[model samples]
Target: MSAIASEVLISRLADWGVDTVFGIPGDGINGIMEGLRRNADRVKFVLVHHEEAAAFMATAYAKATGRIGVCLATSGPGGIHLANGLYDAKLDHAPVLAITGMQETSVLGTGYQQEVHLDRLYEDVSVYDQMVVNPAQLPALVDIAIRTAYARRGVAHLTVPNDIQVAEAGEQPYQLVAPAKPPATAPVYLPPPVRPRDSDVRVAADVLNAGGRTAILAGIGARGAGRLVEQLAVALDAPIIKTLSGKMVVGDDSPYTTGGIGLLGTGPSEELVEEIDTLVMLGTNFPYTKHLPEPGKVKVVQVEIEPTRAGLRLPTEVPLIGDVGATLEALLPLVTPRAERPLLERYQAKMRDWREKMAALENPERDPIAPQYLASLLDRLATDDAILTCDSGTIATWAARHWHIRGGREFYLSGNLATMAPALPYAIAVQHAYPDRQVIAYPGDGGFAMLMAEFHTAARYHLPIKVVINNNNSLGQILWEQMVLGYPEHGVRFGNPHPDYAAWARGCGGFGVHVTKAGDLETALREAFARPGPALVDVAVDPNEPPMPGKVKYEQAKHFAEAFLRGQPHKASIATTLFKDKIAQLKES
Candidate 1:
């Protein structure tokens, strides 16, 4: 018997080195599910509680592994559910292929059950969108989807009709053409390294040499070029400022780095951006344009593999379009080394002061379990090579300011989209990628509740993921945002009492720990880390504790005061905590 289209689809994916498929199954995709089942030894299907989580898992897997992440969903609602995560991949430029089911070709527009125009629905989010109407189209379509995703560094979607999925495929050899090589029977596809031209590299070097104080803003693009980035920093006597996605480029405690940039950044970094004459951006188009040095004030030399992203965020005097490692290798030789290191020294000192200020906030003896203290405790307990993920909101703030990046540790969060609840799913995918490494997910109460069912998914897989929930019982980030905008906090708090997330973990066949007091936080985190399987540590933190920006503007202070005057909830406690934190920061200054 000829192989079915679904079998061809899975076979082609495995040929592209895809080892896992993340998705939830439904009747519409039953044929595809059988394909996954038959090819279980080749490509494993991870069952997710929700289609959205599956999409998130795929996006994160792509980001973490530098491979084409594939996600599957049934027709109609399942396909619609994938939009958010696919958009996340698009914005962050993760290479992902979404395989969603469609109604039978006979009833595509007849409004049949689960009849979703998935190809039309995915056009905006995908770099390549197509539907397989025949079995012969499956293998070629799969190859095109994966190739397009890799080439464009964005989502590629292939929607297959139910009838087409089970149809017999024609005899076709699976041929994979390696870059600059003839077609081979073996499945091997490797992307060619991108390099900037010598002339462009020289122009960038000239721009850098012209400036006196140069600061390197390392983004996610500098992931594999840490040593090169350090060499350039040392040569220029420059301080490195990491974007959130670029946190692992260098350790947070490195002397060359002033820590992160933007609102979740360090005060020294803010000052460094204000003072630098030249800014060297590596592989990161940081979305917060306001935090960047004003155009023309700093001569910008940007290095990026994607040409469109080179000058997107800041005005570039010289844009070197190429791989970060390759570009840095070419430009570093032409750039002149500096001897005077006053600016780097000054920023290093400020970074030390910032660390001291943060230490005071991370005091474990504080009565209410401070989220900073919880993050610090987890940092102390996690392994050197642990992979940590955090959701957006106050949890991200705590993770950003408190958790120190050390050793081989890596951190990931929703970068451009800044969506909530991806932490748990990301942790699951990373754990699947590296089973032996410690994987932790830190999410706020609101975000955790959004995708809480995924905890059971972790349990089902025996993923051994440690989830630490910052149970503030409120949408803490938005509450502060409202206050910052001079509006009273409204509808951000959870009117219903918060559920026992720890208990839920236990119910889902995992270990659980609840820490209501500050002193118990360390013990709880330690226990969760040591547990044999998936675990949850739910710590009730102070909801009134604000995530203050690195440098508070007078307008922000005025608006916060105005919010209190306009009768904000928990105004007294919020004001007290903010005042106390500010006083500590001022003392460090």
Candidate 2:
């Protein structure tokens, strides 16, 4: 029996182990919707409120599972809305497949209604961008798209015309002029174990062995190789500074770790980056050159899967171009173990002091609840195996510093893109992926308000995802950036009052709790976690409280003072809040 191209496409994805697809139904792509209806048992369609959220959900799935996340959208506006989220996947190196619809081929280039050339639109962001004009192209095109997405660790886009979607396909695959066989019969492309050459490994080992004070910078690329990284750290007696993407690579509980680097980093990490003479970068291309040591001052050893990224960030004495785990495994045997790690011990002590300093801010007695307290409380209340995601804002800083990853917990954020409004969608996708696991979201008021409708998606699906909103009613991060850049805070605050998010959650058929007082915060969180269905807790936090950097630069302090002097709004309140924070720290000391 002949099958429609849409069915063929859906079937191909199912065969490749795609169990769920995130998208919304539209008339432009009715045929694909019908295909989904037919294959309901094999491939489940998760209906999202918007195409942007759908793409975000797909990216989240890819990040959490390392599988090719698929999102569907209709032509024109629908496809256009997907750009933001697809870029998120592209920038973060998540393998994602985006399928968008196009107008019927009969219209050609007649400026047909919603006749968007999706292939051209996606060219910049996609690894493989193509439009299907023939039914016979599915078997090869789908395979190649998926394969390229995996190979490049980026997005692949396929646009099917309205007519082409329902076209009957022949049993035989399209013949393409290529050196290799048709991809239809090609087994799923799984990345093979890649290790660096013996000479390169030896060179890297030599650099590490000769260093006086060494440090390891691990990124998302170091994920799944946690044990190997930890072993390497112990062998070298080096401190591990994680990029935000790699926060879970080694738990903050580990003595060797000094948490993160850059603006959202810990005090110990800042010191470690500046003081270390030798730096070993593992599977991370951390871009903050200012936070990194001066190039010629520190000898560098970098291991990367992509050869192009090896020396992209800094000059490298040894560039081990291979998979992080395999390269580290090969190098570990050659590395000489260090006996007395006075530098490592010193940083460990600093890490303890930093933790204490951070912990002191988690005060429950504060009138307007501190964001730090909320983050710390969430850390304590959340399950050991919970999956946590936070929006890109001051919320990220709080999550990075306060939430310590322990047990089987995994954390994700916008990372490189630093985009907002991803946490809720990420939570929904993760909850859908692991129905039994606890999935939580931490988004600020500004971000949550962007894609607030997605809460209904969770409610409609009856996902037991928990959302914790740090209701500060301002663009906290950008506001601070302006102050630090000597500009008065302008158009940063959300006017008047913010919506009652708890009421919105309840309206969407989910559990809701609004906590305005510090004493009520813990009870609301406990209630949200205990809910059987989707729940949201909107906790009012101090808007004036700044997310201070680990090591405040001299220029930053000077600029902040200038901003305050030059008619910054709410300057007195901000000054008072800053003073209270310092007083609390002094009392703790």
Give the winner by lDDT: 2
Name the candidate that leads on TM-score.
2
Give lDDT tens digits, candidate 2, residues 440-515: 9999999999999999999999999999999898999999999999999998998786688999999999999889
Among residues 3 or more apart in sequence or in different chains, the pairs in candidate 2 whose N, CA or C atoms overlap within 3 Å are none
Q: Candidate 2: where are CA atoms >4 Å away?
A: 171-184
Error of 2 at 180 (Å): 15
Q: Name the lDDT value of residue 411 in candidate 1.
A: 95
lDDT of each: 0.88, 0.91
Taking all chains together, the TM-score of candidate 2 against the true structure is 0.97
TM-score of each: 0.96, 0.97
RMSD per prediction, one decimal?
A: 3.6, 2.2
Instruction: Judge candidate 1 at residue 312 and give its lDDT.
Output: 91
